[model samples]
Target chain A: MSDNKSLQSSRREFLGKSAVAGAALAAAGSGLVLTRMAEARAPDQPVSNKVRWGLLVDAARCVDGCTDCVTACHEENGIEQSGHAETDPQWMRKVELKDERTGYQLSLPMMCQHCETAPCADVCPTGASFIRADGIALVDRHICIGCRYCMMACPYKARSFEHETVTKQKPHAPRGKGTVEACTMCVHRVDSERLPACVEACAAAGHNAIMFGDLKDPNSEIARKMASEPSRAMRADLKLNPGVRYQGV
Target chain B: MAKMKNLYYRNIEGTSPGYWGLLGALALMIVAGLGAAYYMEHHGHIVTGMSNQVVWGLPHVFAIFLIVAASGALNVASIGTVFGKQPYQPVGRFSALLAMALLIGGLIVLVLDLGRPDRLIVAMTKYNFKSIFAWNIFLYTGFLAIVGFYLWAMMDRMVGKYYKPAGVVAFVWRLILTTGTGSIFGFLVAREAYDAAILAPLFIIMSFAFGLAIFLLLIMGIYGATDRELSDSVLRRWKNLLGVFVAAVLLLVVIYHLYKLYITRTHGIESFILLNGGVYTSLFWIGQILIGALLPLFIIFTKLGHSRFWIAIASVAVIVGGIAQLYVIIIGGQVYPLPLFPGMAASSSFSDGVVAHYAPSLPEFLLGMGGVAIALLAVLFVVKVLDILPESLGDAVLNPPAAS
Candidate 1:
């Protein structure tokens, strides 16, 4: 009986070792392929100042009563609805406008303009609020003490504070309670050379109102369009030099 | 010198049931406040009235008021030692003590209300040098230290000579401190209600009025509780000074509003605050102007000012008015929608172009009251342990012949 038990134990050990070796081999193969793919796509480098990402919104093409972009942003960012409209965090929203005298109406999506000199970054006490080399304003949650001073300083009112504890957070966007957050312009996707969720969603919905590209790259489609068309920055009087421009508004 | 030699200071016997009851109540309030703060921190600020729109609420108002009053409280010491006013000299020590107490109280509220209260150590360590909030941490701590040294110099005969220099340093430091506080709001160019240079001096004048009112009330309360002899002359002088300070504040308010009204860009904000801002407008006209400014001014300026009861009423009025004024400034400023689109009405899910509503919850009110209780309790504890209060504050003791 003892000899039979030892034989069974040895057989089980051998199977476990084979399984471990197979898993390790599979992981190594994937790692090598991923490295090669990354190297082939672009140099593994930090965000550089060479590329200044921006968005151009054609208000004329933007449809009224459609929130595909807003919904896409919420889903991509994992921003939940807490059933409290007044206190929920909104990274992006559709703003409806009406000219009082003209009776003309317009609809456009508003988010962080990603200014060259952001007021939110200027007022952050711990330097937790900062602008990246690529001119993306972001709050470093590690350092953000949640004073909300940045929200008060924002000219566009683009920032929102996470009032409730966030249970589910997207892997790319780490959100929690007692922190300030805003439209990152989908920095995660931007770094990966992919369009922001909102921009893609807008395009998918056939509005094609939003255009995303590098402002620094003159040959870029967005840059060419901007050069040809007259576009205005919201609250340009503040001299924020917002990356987002609007046309036909 | 003869009167000084005759004057005696002693600690209060804190054995009475009444004294114990008062201490117990204050301690209870402080504990309640801490509990509320902890609940808010654990549950998140969603439990409070503060939101993305109205970022600051009742606690900020209380904290700012206490801090402003603290700097103003030291004015008595400055007048006595720096300006060489003999009559004001007797209250200098108490002024320094109260200043420290009020500052400690205000700072507690400010720190506790933070979303990351546990990261207070981080705030102390890391700093954005350009930020006014960073500058204020240094200003607040420095004010406490300077006042502490000034108090020692005044109380200790060995370092008595240092009193004048210490007083001068503290006076200058306080001016800079109050200026920094005002600049917290004044420097916000995004907000139409702020971004004015006059706000600095306006806050200074406000500090003078608020600080004097609080000081007067403390002195009166202590004197009455101890059954000590307080001169009618000193009370009357303080009353007159308070009247002058109130008038100065009212004048500054008028100028600030008029300046906002004159600017075309700020006209919308000015009209909103003064006319169409429903609760805010009423708070300005009825709460701040009538109850806070006008009634207090009337009490202090009239023959009723002679009575201690009336003077106390005026002090209470001033404090009430001060809260109303802050509410209008902090909450009212936020409720007025930002003009994202000029000549166009904006509507959004984010409450854009609509006045944001705020109703401070029980926890916020308790937290603010806890700050007030902490200040009072500190005074109580200090007086019980140290001979901070004089046995009698009669005219003879206050105005010595040698000092004159």
Candidate 2:
């Protein structure tokens, strides 16, 4: 008789807790609807020019031997080395620079600068090479034709051709043989309000040399830094207005 | 003036064993070239010497040479029909046939070399108006159509009046086509070697030299094989013309390099090509200057100029030199390191600050040779089927009947 009474009391307690949880959810749902009505935009919209993605690299803080960013990019993009050094595709790489006069040396990662007026886009025969609304330069493989004309046109030499057939590929980054590719600024992660793999890895390694943010927002950290510090674009004489900027070289 | 009725046009009889042997050889070459192309497609471009550093290779050199030569071959018809030169009229039909054959060969090589040959439909349908390559698609196709009409106009007496008009249109079209080809490299601002506008005219002159040299060889070979009598006067005129074109090409090359040397920014590339570029420097001086230009010029201008054999040798030399020139231009242009940073030296795992290396593979060489074979095969087949070649290109047939 005591066991039966204990089971009945436990069932009664569960019913009481369920009633209170239901009431709380109802209230929260109404609040959420009201919040949605007050907002000016939808949650799922296409990328727009209102947000211009940019990267600010602090050369002073960029460690000479740290390859965290390059490693992160390769891992994230599924770029593999084919053991052929000269023919293999490299979307991102670290360049070592030495001062001719003083023998001082520095190292920094180099990639597609994502220029507003990209030469690759201009020379592409099928209009496959294009700049996104958010200023990321991209090649639409559907019509690229693999002529390598865009590769010849790029000034940074940032682009690479897949010389061999590719088997394994990340779903978000589709790479194939005979097409040209370059850095996409991790557009997939950026869409989900997550930092790019390179930027995240740089920070995780404690260097904190790379900053990625919206260049259009004046109050954003990257914009504020650009305004305060005298940063320059690579090959500024080309006047390509690259989205990526460097504070020191 | 009475219309001449004795100018006979007869097709070649293909019953000879030698003719069949020639055809068989060319067929084998085409099959090999196709096989190589298929291998490249299946295995990817890694099989070829081309890399991210050297994007273009020996196949490009061959394709460009043939394409440029095709445009120049049309000049004979233009001079005869459009310019109203009497002596060139007898060879006009053959000239048109040669142009068509060469262009078809070049187009085959270019199409086969594509990274995705299957996507040729996309290349045709999709249009990038700003791109010179896109424009070339139209130019190339238009050339084939115009030349076809020009050929018909020359061959058929019914459309004889259209000959001059067709020739004029074809002439203009070819000039534009060659300019477009040259502009493919010339418009590239990233490469220090190719930015100049002069490449347009330079290519025009190059076509004249290369096209005429091939034409002379073809005429000599055909006449020799058939036991046809080719007059010395006719041969001499062609030799002199070839010599003048070769000299013009040499002068333009000198001017192009000299202009580049004057620019401070281009000094690095200039010095690399003229002095420090190891293999490229030797090719420029020896292959292009000595074997290609000077030797041919010497042979054509000397007492040996009277000999048909020496003239033929001179033509062969010009062709060799043309290949060497294109090699330095196409491959050499890419191997040089791009100056990404103005003053600072750059080092990367990708060979950023150093010169890139390239060596053409067997497949590339075979594919290039295949393009040549395709041209020869086309000429062989067309001559056997159609009455394109005249019975005699002698002075009697060349000059009109002294105005009745």
Candidate 3:
């Protein structure tokens, strides 16, 4: 029995070492393939305006009574409701709009439009509300005095004031009571060359209503769709030039 | 009514039981306000009536009224020195002091209502130049400094020569200050309820009305308490001025509404404020128009309003009305949903197309009153130590027999 145990231990050690080496090689090969598949931002490099990220929503394809995107978004951002629905922080929501003349109803997900000239950033007394170089609007919660001026200034009703203390946030997303917050367009995922959780979820659910790409890149799917489709932003009269646009609204 | 060649100033006798009672009451309110602020900070804004929809609730109504009235209070001093109005000269010192007091009170309420009051330092350090809210920091603080200097020049004989120059600066600064205040709302192109340049002028007129009401209250409270002679003739002049200002505010309100009515796109906002806005409509018609504007105007001009008692009543009415107007302007604009889809209706869990409801909580009410208490307490205490009030504002001293 002692001789059998020693032989088995030696064989197990060799197999463990071989498995570790084989797994390391597979990871390296996959990493190289991923690098060629999509370019991710370096850790230290500053975000640049060269890549103007945008989202294109096809209202026609956005199925009514479907909230897969909202669910996926909340899951990805780790947003938990405190049961106060009226004052709860919502990074994204689905709104149903009806044509006044024709009563035709369509539902589209609504979040921060990420306007070029954001009123939230403009009215922020502390400059805490700002649009990133990559065209994502964000609140620098550190400096946010939670004046709610940004909430008042947002035309799309895109912002919500965090009314209660938030605990157990996702590692990537940090939220707290008092400051106003809204959609970040999944900046963490975008920087890592992945689609927003909502966009990926929408495709997975087979609705395929959402499209994500660099708007400045004319060859991108979003740019081509925006050029071909009759997409228009809500409140176009305000002239905010939003990065997020909807088609067939 | 005319200004006396030489004005004599004396400190109020602070030993009176009545004066002590008033001070004690004000101190109580200040303490209560501080407590309310702490409660809010401890729990967060969820405790307040304010939601994502109604961001600026009742505290704003109080704060904006006080701030606007602060700028208008200086109008008295401006009238005396800048316009060479003699009757207003004796009251210039009190006017400047009241302006500072009102501003201090308003700013206190505004700051305490902020979400992260601890980060007030962040607000002071960060400056977004494009923001009118940012511009207001300079306007509010500068008004205090310039007015403080103006007061020193008026009260002290050493810098008496610079009184008129300083008055000119303060006058211009106050005007710019009110414009900045008005523009805070007017520049919000996102909200249809605001976004009008006419709001700037409307605010200036409002300041005149609200400021004078507070001024009248101070005069009556001081002179009435001290048993000083406050003749009806002087009261008559002030009432007439109050009447004119009240009328001007009414006219501007009409014009602002007419402008909104003419624009077909703004029809929804117009309907909200004028017709279907349940609480808002009531406040506008009953609180603002009838009680605040018309009733005060009637009391100021009519023979029935001839007594000192009637003038005080009118002033209180204006004060009440000013708050109502601000409530309508600040909160009313917010309760009406943003015109996101234009003619189209949008529905969401966020109350996108619906009228959001707000009922100001007790803590909010107490917090606002606390601001008032602080202002009143400061003004009254300063009067105790300094010769801010006159020995007499009698017709004889104001318009002497020899001068007449």
Candidate 4:
């Protein structure tokens, strides 16, 4: 009698799950799912020029050995964790810094920086490297000839070339061999009003080292932090005016 | 009277078995090179030894060498027509042909090495005026047209009068072309090994040495094959000019290194390339300094240098040394670590804060060799079909019997 009762309950559970799956399939096939996806960021809306997306890192808060941000970035972006570090497509990496005179040691995540006048974009022969309207730098892999000139031009070594065929890439991130790539500053997530994976991961890890926001907006958290904190751009001598600012660096 | 008594021009007697053998060898190399390119392209850059740090490898060394040499090869034509050097006049046609062929070879390698060779049309159509590379596209194409027109002026009797004007245009264009090529490296503000005002002028001088070396070998090889009387006086003049260019190259190299050594910021890069960078340091001291500069200078300046064999040896030395120089400049420059912060030590998982390593793979080498084969084959085939060669460069024929 107990076995029979258990069988009946199992059947009921299967049927209920089948009903929900059926509704989801119908919703997907009928374009409802597509419309909801567009609701995150409208398809017809023009990218805002008034906003500049940036990341501010408080190096003091970042633990030297922790790699929560790195883990989050690679996983979120579907970057292959190929054991070969030299050839791997590293969109971002943890950089350890030490001042020779002061003996101060610090570590921070270095990425695209999304400069106002990006050298990568400036040196690209085909205009494949460009700054988006919202001030995020990007590569239009469509036109990147993979000449690696941009790689040479970049001061921070932020860009990476797709050395091998990319397999099982996340649908949200498009990548292939023979083109350049780098941190898009999580543009896909930013488009949908979501925080960057690295920023979220850092906060979740209780480090709260990385903050993502609109640098141009005075009221933004990142902007307010910059106003109050002692933060600076790496390689500021170049006058690239990078959007990614750092503190305790 | 000088025109009436000028040296006769004719197509090479191509019936020789040796000619066929040479062509076959070059063809095989071309096939091998093309196969390597296909494999690399199909498999992606993983098949090659290049990485993000050593982004450019052997293919670039070959391509840049050929391109720089292309400008230098045109010097013969420039001297003949613009400078009115009577001895160089007869060889102008071959010189122009060589210039075009070398450029074609270099460009083929450069395009094929691109991550998107198929999107070459996009590179042509698009424009990033700030980038020196964008300007090179125009410069390279313009070179071919202007030089081709100049060649037409030399060959076609109807347009013969325009030879001098065309030569001047071609000469000026070639200088700018080489400058653009040099500035490709010079314009990079970040690279400690490359970004310098001296690089542009250095490349110009390098072209003179590299281009002339290849030209010397070709002229001698063809003349020897045809059993033509190439006089010692002509050889001496050619060899001495080569010596001068090689010396000038050596001088610039010193200035380049010395200037950098004076700048403390560049000290790390300078020491790496000059003192203990292993292969790079050896190539700089031995390959470039010894074989490329000193040995060639020794051969061309001494009493035995007048011999055709020694002259030929000097030319080959120069060629080897030229490749070495370029290898140091292109590959060595890349392998050095890029300093992001001047006063701080930095490390990253991205190969930052470390000296990068690069080894040329077989496919990359083959692909580069294929470009070289294509260049040589073009030169060989064109000379056989056209009246590009003068009948003889003997002192007797060049001087003519003093008209009574």
- The local lDDT score (0 to 100) that residue A191 gets in candidate 2 is 71
For A130-199, candidate 4 gives per-residue lDDT tens digits of 9998999999988888899999899888989888888988988889889999999888999988999999
lDDT per residue (tens digit) for residues B205-284 in model 4: 88988888899899999999899878778778988999999999999889989989999999999999999999999999
Error of 3 at A49 (Å): 0.6
Off by over 4 Å in 2: A1-45, B1-5, B400-404
Model 2 C-alpha lDDT per residue in residues B1-404, reported as the tens digit of each score: 12444567777777789999999999999999999999998999999999999888898999899999999998888888788876677778888889988998898888888888899999999988898999999999999999999999988989888888899999999999999999999998888888888899899999999998999899888877876656678788888999999999999999999999999989999888889999998888898999889999999999999998899899999999999999999998999999887778889988888999999998988898899999999988998899988777666666546674
DockQ of each: 0.58, 0.74, 0.69, 0.60
Please give, for residues A116-198, the per-residue lDDT of candidate 1 as tens digits: 98888888889999888888889998888888889889988999898888988999999988889999999889877789999
Q: Which portions of model 4 miss their true places by more than 4 Å?
A: A1-41, B1-4, B400-404
Candidate maximizing DockQ: 2
Model 2 TM-score, 2 decimals:
0.94
Tell me how candidate 4 scores on lDDT.
0.90
RMSD in order of candidates: 6.8, 3.2, 4.2, 6.7
Error of 1 at A73 (Å): 0.9
